[model samples]
Target: MTEAAAPRTPGSPCWVSLLVHGMGTTQDFYADLFGWEFVPGPDQLGPYVRALIGGKEVAGIGQLPPDRHLQVAWTTYLASDDVDLTAEAVRSCGGTVAVGPLDAGESGEAGRMAIAADPGGAVFGIWEAAAHLGTALAGAPGTPVWNELVTRETSTVCKFYQTVFGYEAEAEVSADFDYQTLRLDGRPVASLHGVGHALPRDRGPHWMTYFEVADTDEAARRVVELGGQVLHPPRDGASGRVATVADPEGAAFAIVRSTTAG
Candidate 1:
C-alpha cells in the first residue's frame, strides 16, 4: 500500500464519497474489489462510512436520504481553504450549490462541505477539513490514481474550474478532441476531455474518478462477476490499461493499471 497523505493544495481532488443504496452490499462490492475496509462515521454524521486502505482513509460511502431520488455515483471533493468562499465562486462562475456550506460533523470533525456543480452540470464538492483532511492514500492498488472531467462542454467547464480553483491548462492531449490537462501548481492534477463519438453517452457533464488496480483485465472481469457492468473493455490509454465500469447499483467509475506505478 502506498503511504496515505492528505491533499495539500487548494485545487487538489482531496476526497471522494459515494451516495448509494444497500450500504452493506455497496461496501462489500468495493471491499472485495479494492481491499478497502469500512468504518462507521461519527454518530452525528448519520449513515456515513469511510473506506480505508492499509488503515488509511481513501474514500467514503453514505446512504441516500429516503426522500431524495438521485442516481448512485461517486462525488469528488476538491480541497478548499474556505467552503463558503468557494461556493460563492462556484455561483459567480455559473455553477450552482446543490447542498451545504454546512458543517460535516456536530463539532465539525469532518469539515465544512458543500456540493456544487460547474456550468456544464458536473457535480462536485468543496471541503475545508477540520479533523479529517480527506483521502490518506493514493497511487496504489485500490487507491485513486486520477480524476477527469468527461464533458462535451470542455471549454466552458474548463473555464469555470479555472476561475473557481485557479487551475491552468498545462497540456493538450488532443486538439481535435478538446482533451486537455488541468494543472495546479504546475502539476497535472486532473484532466478535461470532450465527449468522444465512441464513448458512452453520459446524461450531462460529470467528473469520472479513476482508481489504480493491479490488473485492468482482472478487475473488469471481477466487476462483471460481482454483477456490475463493464462499460468499457480493458484497453490501452495514454496513462495505462484502463476500463470503465458501473457498480451493481449503477455508479460508474474507472480502473487503471498505471504504466508506471507511483
Candidate 2:
C-alpha cells in the first residue's frame, strides 16, 4: 500500500471515478467487494461520494443526472498542472473537450476538472487539484493499481497524448502486438494497447481501470456473488493474475493481484 500525500505529477494517472444510475446500490456493491467506506465528496457534479480505505481516499462514485443517459464506466483522470491549458492542448491535438475546465466544489476549492475525448473517442478527464488531491491511497488490495487505454491502435493516440501531456512513449518491440507504456519523469504511469478488431463494438475506445486484490480468483467469485458478472475469469497476464468483471449496472473493470505490488 502507498499513500499519495503530495501532488501527483502531471500526465500521471491520479484518480479513477465511476458514474452510475443507482448511487446507493453501486456504493454497496463496491464497499462489499473492496471493503471501502463512504464519505461525502464534492457535489457540484451530482450526488458524489469518495471511497475510503483506512480513512484514505481511494476512488470516487457519483450519481448520474437522470435525464442524461451515459455509460456507467470508470473514468481515469490524469493529473495536470493547469487544467485549462491542458484542455486547450487537448483541443489543439485533435481531441474534444466535452465538459468544462470549471471548479468542482461549491466555493471553487475542491479543484478544477474537464472531461475530454481523444481523436479516437476515448474519454478521460484532466484534474488540477486544490483541496482535493486525486487518489490519496493506492497499490494495496482494493486500491487502483493501473490505468490502460484500450484502443484500435496505439501509434496515433500515443502521439496525441505525448503531444498534449509530454508523455514519453515506450512501445513494445513486436510486429504481432502493439502496446505502449506512457511514462512521466522516467516512471511508467499509464499504458496504451492497440487491440484492432478485438475492440468491443458496444463500447468503443475507452480507458480501463484495474484495482488490486489479494486473490484474483476469489475476487472474481465475489463479484459474481454480489449481483455482478465475471466478464473474464481470472487468468495470468503480463502484470499478474487478473479478471475482468462488471457491476450490476454493467460497468466493467478489472481486479488483479499485481506482481509488482509490495
Candidate 3:
C-alpha cells in the first residue's frame, strides 16, 4: 500500500492542490465525488480552501487568477527543508522557478513554498513544512496515493530531479513501458514515465496525481456521470486496475486500486 505516515522526508511528495477557475464548482465536484469536506484555509492562504478527508486535511483548492494563461491542474508538492535553497537547486538543475519561495500562510503558520517546473515543463511545488505539514492521510479512498511525472524529455527530467532532490530511480518495470520508480532513503516515493508516444503530439509535460479508490471501473463510471470525462478506460496494470480521467474543467488525474505493495 502507498500508506504514508507523518514526518515526510525531503524529496517525498507531501501535498497536492488544485488550481481552478470555478472554485466553488470544483470544490463541490470533488467533495461529492470523493466525500471530502471543504473548509477555509489560513488567512494568508487567501482564496485557497483546505480539503479534508475524515476531518483531516488531505488536499487543497486554490483559485486560479483571472487573465492568467495557466490551466486548471493538480500540482504535487514535494517536501523540502529550505524553500529558497531548493529553488536555487531547481535552477541549478535546469528547472525554472514559476512562483515564489515565499511565505505560504500567516506569520510562521505554515512553511514557505515555491512553484517550479522541470526542464520538460512539468510543474511541481516545494514545501518547507513548519506548523503545517502536508497531508496526514494516504493509501485510502479520497486521498492522493502516488505522484508521477509523464513527460517527453524523460532523461532530462530524471537527471534534473535526481540532482535537485537526490532521488534514486530504479527502472525495473520493463524497457517497453519505460517506467522508473523514484525513491528517497531507499523507499519508493514517486515515479517517472515517458509517455510522449502515447499522448497527443501537442500535449506537454505534466505531473499526474493518482488517487486510490475502492474500484477503478466504478470510479470511472461515476466520473462520467458527474460530467467529467474518462480519458482512459479501466485497465489492469502492474500496480492495479487504473483509469485516467479529467474533471469538468479539464484537469486530468488518475484513479487506481493497487494490488502490489506500493
Candidate 4:
C-alpha cells in the first residue's frame, strides 16, 4: 500500500466521501465489503466518520440531516491550495458552487471545502487541506484507485476544470471514444468521458469513484450479499476487471482489480 505522507498535488483527487440517510447500515455495509474501520470526525456538517484501512484514512461517510434531501453518491474531492479562489474560478468559468468555500470541523482543522458543478452538471468537491490531508493510504484493497466524470461531452466540462484547477487535458485518440485524462505535474489525476445518451437517466452527469479490490468478481458478489445491487457485472476494461455497484441506499461506485495495483 502507498502511504500519502505528503500533501497531494493540486488538481489531483485527494479524497472521496458518501453522505447517506442511515449511518449505521451504511457503516455496516462498507465495513463488511471493504474491511474498513471507522473513526469519528468533524460534526459540523453532521455525524461523520472517516474510514480507515490499515490504520490510515481512506474515505469518509456522513449522515445527512433528516430534513435535507440530497443524492446519495460518492463525492470526489480534488486537492487545492485555496478553495475560495477555486470556487471563484468555478463561478467565473460558468460553473456553479453549490456549497461552501467554508471551514469544516469546529476548529476548522478538517479543511476548507466547496462543492461545485461543472458546465455539464457533474458535481465534485474542492478541498484545501489543513489538519486533514484527504485520503491517506492507497494502492491497496479498499483504497480509491480512480476518479472519473461521466458526462454528455468532454469539451466544455474539460475546459471548465482546466480553467479552475490548471489541469492539462490529454484527449484519447480514437474515432469512437470521447475520453480525456486530466493531468497534474505530468501525471494523470482524473478522467472525463463523454457517454452521450448512455448517461444514466437518474444519475445524469456525476463523478464516479473506483476503489481497488483484490478481485472484482468477488467484490461484486459480496456487494449483493451485503444487500447492495450490482449495477454492472465484472468486465474487462483497459485498466483491469471492473464492476459498478450501488450501496443499499443507492450510492454508486466502482470496484476494480487494477492492472498495475501493487
Relative to the true structure, candidate 1 reaches a TM of: 0.94
Q: In candidate 4, how many Å is residue 100 off? A: 0.8
Model 2 over residues 1-262: C-alpha lDDT tens digits? 7799899889989899999999999999999999999999798888999999999999999999999899889999999999999999999999999989899997769899999999999999999999988889878899998999999999999999999999999999999899999999899999999999999999999999999999999999999999999988999998999999999999999999998876
Candidate 2 weakest lDDT stretch, 10 residues: 101-110
lDDT against the true structure, each candidate = 0.86, 0.94, 0.85, 0.93
State the local distance difference test value for candidate 3. 0.85
Instruction: Write candidate 3's Cα lDDT for 126-183 as tens digits.
Output: 9999878899787878889899998874677898989999999888655667677899
Give per-model TM-scores: 0.94, 0.98, 0.94, 0.98
lDDT of 1 by residue, 104-221 (tens): 8777877898999888778898999888888888788988888998887477778888999999985465656678788987899898888756445645677899999999999999
- Native-to-model Cα distance after best TM-score fit, residue 58 in candidate 3, in Å: 0.9
Give residue 222's error in model 4 in angstroms.
0.5
Can you tell me which runs of candidate 3 are displaced by over 4 Å?
1-5, 43-45, 260-262
Flag regions of model 4 displaced more than 4 Å.
none
Model 3: clashing residue pairs?
Answer: none
Error of 4 at 143 (Å): 0.5
Q: What is the C-alpha local distance difference test score of candidate 4? A: 0.93
